[model samples]
Target: MSHQSGHQHHIWVQSHHPVKLEPKLPQPLPKEPTFYYFAYGSCMCPVDLKRSLGENTHHYVIGPSILQGYRLGFYVYSPTRKCGVLDIVPDPKASVKGVLYQLPWRLSEYLDKREGVAQGLYRHELVNIHCQDQVYQDVRTYIVVDKLAEEAAPNDWYFNVVLRGAVTCGLPEEYCWHLFNHMYNLQQRNQERQLRESA
Candidate 1:
């Protein structure tokens, strides 16, 4: 675990977000079948992922990776989390940084359930990811079925989990700062809107 030091800006949130340490090296694939997964949202956090998959996922992580031709947006409200959640939108000039995993096929159904695939909230998107100087093809990721017209603000919990995963997984420092600032700005704007409406 590396920490971001000497940064001028501070993340303004009322709660403590803990980042649990995980093994950097991924476990070798089993004799059973496996599939590649790229996670850009709360799923990036192995702790949260384990909660859904019902198993330890840290060992499944293939580390921080990049996805080209797509950018992140908070385009859907999650009834479960009661907040806006992440989605990937096509953007030719943009790229998303996230965690990549090679997971056993047994966990596939759980993963789909977590993404609300059965309810049609999200659908699989096969993509190519760049990891450790190599390009991985036909990786599975989820995208919003119906995106909001405008971006929405993520709640503090979702925001923190995302940042924790990014930092813990060793994403680029500059990209992490950009993510922090983007979410912070959205939260601040949302708060302001709420205050104005209340007044």
Candidate 2:
């Protein structure tokens, strides 16, 4: 099948069967039923998510959830925070505690912007999550592109924000502690360097 800009390439075709290109729609159509998102990072914080989505966030119903086979990690650098942001790393024996929210399908665009999709910093991916004995499939979440960023320790403010969100969502104390203690103290390390420089 021949590929072109803004055209759908056909997958099934034999030498005898000529490939028929599907015409592009003049306008995009909305797909239903609802949009569900899994927030494993600071987005799990209602305060942060509200700040990101503003009043649009009111359209969502949110609750605590768990994503298995992934663990919380600090690696996505936040220039504004001068530290790393939260990301989920795949692990065979670990799970990440997070929040699950359902919103109107249209609101995905807003969330996408907040996550810097256009900037190529993060991308939306669908994954399964478990909440309250229910398993949710095709729940979208933001994940950092591999090999695009260097791992860095999160600063105090960034770390606290993640901790606060985890606490707010009532994630297990053990998990919360692990999150709180696992991050590196780049701020402190810089302070020590400054002290040494002065001496």
Candidate 3:
């Protein structure tokens, strides 16, 4: 992707990296602190995020966004859902589409919690988002720190959440097609497994 003038983005080549703490907040949190968060997984779905983050989800204003130099992967295991979650792996040749949400800065801590950041599952990092023909710098996002040795395909319901969000946000049809094919294959295998279990 061509870099726009004055927009210098960090080149993240490592898929697994160390965790870092958020910058310490001043004694009194700024009133109405706001942040731009890039959601490239289930969080891309407002319903999914609100299920965990609660009703204040109204605070999020989402728009279609692109993350360059990365590819979405499903190696982040979720103990609660007993399935895999989405994470972006550094890919010099690919770009992933999702949603960019403007949210209150104070909610970052809660988001980190929802992402299991404190458990060393995922780490918070700054990502570059391209939206509205502009490059947004230092946008916050989560990256998996400990990926499962064997990648796990997401369940149908979970994958549907991402598919719905992608379509709702008007992502390119080509991208949606790619996800749809992947989901179809995974769902078929899962159904076969159910048959075997019943047998």
Candidate 4:
């Protein structure tokens, strides 16, 4: 008898199967030392902040906040960006609206580097921030080391980024409009000056 006839034969088939995997959930941020930061400029944009901080910053954002006793100004010229950047100036009657963050302490050095702290382009200023019916004290922000005598216009790139950050981070609609007008007026003035100089 044939060897196959000694026992009942069984056929085994193998088939490729697709796996059903559960969607991955975002991991919670690691517990670590953190610091409160108030961003009034390009840093207000999480997209921009991520570029420097080397990580996503959206999770760190608290929300739109008010910096009382201060006003926003474009008093610093960035040679790197080739435009004027925002700075906070003391003004008792004015308030600056900006994004607040509770960033990991590890990001402090990166933020400092981005702010040009070592180069003295900006220096840290400790202040209070009001957000969501709470006052956060001793929050760190940056100010120009040497402010220009007159405000300077931001380039189109800077202008767009500032406005994008303001809107994306949910700053007040009125404040966003005011910011837009302020930048536009400065740009108009700059264009007129250029035309006159070239003529």
1-199: candidate 1 lDDT, tens digit per residue: 1234323223322123223212343534555699999999898889999999999999999989999999989899888888889999999999999999999999999999999999989999999999999999999999999988977899999999999988888899999999999899889999999999999
- The TM-scores of all predictions, comma-separated, are 0.84, 0.73, 0.76, 0.85
User: Tens-digit lDDT track for model 4 on 10-74?
Assistant: 21111122122112424335546899999989988999999999999999999999999999898
Which stretches of candidate 2 lie above 4 Å from their native place? 1-33, 56-61, 148-150, 184-199
Each prediction's total of clashing residue pairs, residues at least 3 apart in sequence or on different chains, is 0, 0, 0, 0
Q: Is candidate 2 or candidate 4 better by TM-score?
A: 4
**What is the per-residue lDDT of model 3 for residues 51-111, given as tens digits with 9 covering 90 to 100?**
7766546447468899999987777778876777788899999988888988876677889
- lDDT value, residue 25 of candidate 4: 28
lDDT of 4: 0.90
Cα lDDT of candidate 1 equals 0.89
- Which residue runs does candidate 4 get wrong by more than 4 Å? 1-30
- Model 1: per-residue Cα lDDT at residue 143: 97
The alpha-carbon deviation from the true structure for residue 69 of candidate 1, after best TM-score superposition, in angstroms, is 0.5
Per-model lDDT = 0.89, 0.74, 0.79, 0.90
Which pairs clash (backbone N, Cα, C closer than 3 Å) in model 4?
none
| Best model number under lDDT | 4
